[model samples]
Target: MMNFEMPQFALAAPEIWLGVMVCVVLVADLFDRSGEARFAFWLTQLSLLAGVWLAFYTHWGDSGQTTFNGMVVSDSLAALLKAASAALAALTLAYSRDYLRDRGLLKGEFYLLALIATLGMFVMASASSLLVLYIGLELLSLSLYAMVALDRDNRVGSEAAMKYFILGALASGMLLYGMSMIYGATGSLLIGEIMLAASGGENALLLAFGMTFALVGVAFKFGAAPFHMWVPDVYQGAPTAVTAFLGSAPKIAALALFLRLLAEGLGDLQAQWQVMAIILAVGSLAAGNLFALVQTNFKRMLAYSTVSHIGFLFLGLVAGSEEGYSAALFYAISYGIMAAGAFGMIILLSHKGFEAEQIEDLNGLNDRHSGYALVMLLLMFSMTGIPGTVGFYAKWLVLQALVEAGLVWLAVLAVLFAVIGAFYYLRVLKAVYFERVENPQPLVSSRGPRVVVAANGALILLLGLFPDTLIALCRAAFGL
Candidate 1:
């Protein structure tokens, strides 16, 4: 009989810990009647903290190993992303607690599903094979589908869930088909093996066809233009807390997916995929900015803004260099922080029965609470890529990558759309400070969310002031 080698389980400790904790939380919730929800909350937070420590441990000492027979890997990039995602998840739970408790949505199920989704992100970030990536993607998608409908009493929430489920299923099918085609062309399901096969220039036509479908699927997942039909509706319909979770951490996972599939697996096809990225990037910028100009709802506008941000993220990827890839990674991490803060502000301002959703809902925020209003201003500035904010540096780095790659024209077009996008973000600020509050209500008094939100805003400014550290870390992720 052939002997089997034992897998190196230590390399996968972070993911394994997360999986075990999620199960423990689920089982532990069963017997908790009076405090199930709150107990689940602290447990989830503790689990994430443990994950963060384990992720850092991997980054510092236990990397460069492909585990699970090449289905997953431990590397600096994956470790950093896992740590960041875990931190974001913990903060999201903190912001979500008051909102969920107030709305009778404080059930253990919400925390459980969110943790499951976080586990999916971890899987995607560490995936070394196409099959593993797709499994992670499905885990994430299905969890979010249920999350959108968490408020069963709200018909709009139900409608959004159905729409998301249907459209998400279609996207998943496209992605799987694309993966199959790539497997057919390259004769491998592993990304590293696919890269080797693709570099040989065999099955050219099949590779191109598979690449197209795969790019389409990536566009849909990123909510890029032409495939962004589901973003606005779901953001508008989902509870603000769920929206916050939906908007933030998964983005990092998506970026990891792109980097793995294109930059690593299909790097040899740069000439072919660059054009596709350009088209998607330009379309997303135009459609996202123009449409966001007319949106009155805060979350829907954010959804469109997300489209444009993804477009910017694509700029670096299109450049197809180590610096460009790292820049894209930096942008992804920065955007995740900005997005969580943006949606968290909505949760902070909302009350038991009142939703602070409408753009008008933020009118005269400064008059009601100047401190929170200032936080909103910083978040808006960062989202708009204003100077002295991390957003500005993020966009600037991507543009520099494009220019270095000799894509001057595309860079110019991106700047133009970015200017257009600035209008809506400025409009929100105007509502916060210049406009009048239609119905004044006290902001939430919970110190936890407030402190976290303030810290988030401060981070935008702090990172903007000193971006070298993050940029260096990102560069190191790619061994630059």
Candidate 2:
């Protein structure tokens, strides 16, 4: 008798490939113990890039395939977000290299954890089943929980980790309970099946309850208000590079999951959830902007800015138009670049033993390093939604969608809050230009980070001028 086993490698290729790369990074670091680990860092980063490309290359548009029996699914949406996340991961890796080394925190273990977290994001992006989503979410959360504590001797690091883990576990439990309720209600664990069952207005209460619970989890992951109590503390406590990574990439992946799970599968329940979404958006805008006004720490301020941006993102979804969806995706892409560029500049300006993370730290930058100041100025303006920048177009798209969606009043409020948001953004400008500091240190930048800042800043300007190209890409890529 002959027995045959199934070939599972193809189905698990992306995850397994990343795991192997993680091991390779560790081995490389172990063999080379001089602590000049830049080469290992590059290897790890390149592996992430390769893994991201490989996932897309191998998928070949297998959007319909239920790999691992409906666990991992891939499609246009997943591919877009995966590419975005991977790029952000790569950029952050490069941005953090010098900073981490300075802090004695640059290690293969650090990269390995980050890569694993990124891998989990992709998994979550493509999740087709509740079980799979939970697994993906936890994988990312667990890595982050440790990552927050990577600065072993720093007291704030331990505090940040404690807050993150406790809150993360709570959020996870809430999500699981909702998933269980959804399973009980529909008698199925597959998202596709549950969505199908929720259709035609059947099991409305269960679906609604599950959605509320799941949204809580999603909100916590993105650090939205009420659920956002941890963001500023965590951002302040963690090392700057880690905060930069946390600020930039994960939200895009999490937003994709939100779109897929809430807006796609649960599309039928739109009326029920839209109201809840609007409330969250408005509240986030109010709280984030209002509280950010008092922040002295630059990282904490950006953390609040992250929340306000989340609010803007939700505005797109609340529009509930194809155009609205397109707009939100564009915002995600632009925001990722903007956030990375902002933090990249911070890392460039900081020293080996000090964090240049206060607004005052930027004083005299224009006088000392005019070129770097120009990039920072552009990035800050982009964040402020000034014209001739991609951010203007991003905000335009979101505002336009709101108007088109008949949320004119909401749009008005958004614009008003945007004006309020500009206060903090312009405050950065004030320090760089108007305010003066004695004995300023000019920016120190390596080629990689310089190139990143220049390219991102130029892209912001170029895309604003040629909005059609990116707008068209975003339209096509939404594919919803």
Candidate 3:
């Protein structure tokens, strides 16, 4: 007789809870006759809140615990990332609510899809096996694909969705193939076992090939250059609400994926992967900054900015140390907050029959509404990595990690590109404070979104002013 032990399902309490709520929200939305989708909206928010609570409650103290036969993990990192992802999702939904309603895109499906995507992120954060991570990635990717096309009436949106789908599928296939090769070489699907096999330096040639493909997949996911063709088009074409969601929470999940697959599983191959990371980092910084300079479209410019920020995030990975990983994690979380605020401002300025997609549309914003303009100013400053903002601290941490790792030239190069990136962000502030238009439209107002946007902007400054607490939390996630 063979003896078997039950998998400890409780370790994944947050994921399980979120999975249940995704179904509950789906069913609740079906019965909701309110054309405004009030029930579904609030229910989704409640679900997110519960998910955040569960993440911390279940895993706050855990250093690390693998369960589900080593397919899933509960740890400080997973707990923090999951909570942050869920909170960002809630904020994204909050910011999108009024904008979606005004544009007639407010529906139960949007809320449901967002929840499902959040659930996917949770799974990704906790996944310990390559197969489990791939499953989570697909769930997140497919939901995002659908969300991009939710505005079916928009041809540009449909085209963007198709492009995104094809490219995303291709990337997924490459990632799976890479994982298969790794499994074949290591004779195991588990990340720990892969690390053990890789550290032995047996089958070095095959392992290198598999790692190369895996790096490409990771680069594509991060919107790093050479594989970042989809970012600008999708960001510009999707509804502002969808773009806002895409810009924020999914980033935390991507960071989770990067840490798991590269920093954890492939740690033994650090020298090889670190060199590749440096190449991606430099390429992304140059391309993202240079391309962004000419973009008149606000969303497209931010998309390139995102690629550049990913470059900075990669600098930490290039360091290949635990402190570097924590620094990268901090950068990811900070960027997510700033990105949300940036997109939220776009949504705030837009109204029925008007889209605030162009940089010129922001002219005389201060004259029209000083308060909102101030918030926009803060976001722009932060994105520019100016001193006394979270963006600055985030960039500083990455550079510090680089210096510690003896990559002084790379650190200096990053600073140069960062200086180049500042121009476009300054142009945004110039429009807000200096430029005047013939007629400025009144800013739209929704109590919920307005308050959230205000808090979001304040957070950038607050975190900048006192970053140690969050920094410590990030370090703790790595048991440093």
Question: What's the lDDT for all of these models?
Answer: 0.88, 0.82, 0.90
Q: Please identify model 3 stretches exceeding 4 Å from their true place.
A: none
Candidate 3 worst ten-residue window by lDDT? 438-447
Superposition TM-score, candidate 1 onto the true structure: 0.97
| Number of the top TM-score candidate | 3
Residue 144 in model 3: shift from native, Å? 0.2
TM-score of each: 0.97, 0.94, 0.98
- State model 1's lDDT: 0.88
**Ten contiguous residues with the weakest lDDT in model 1:** 56-65
For model 2, how does the per-residue alpha-carbon lDDT over 39-115 read when each residue is reduced to its tens digit?
57778788878867876675545555667667666666676677778878887777888788788887777787888
- As a TM-score, model 3 comes out at 0.98
Arranged by TM-score, best first: 3, 1, 2
For model 1, the stretches where C-alpha displacement exceeds 4 angstroms are 60-63, 438-441
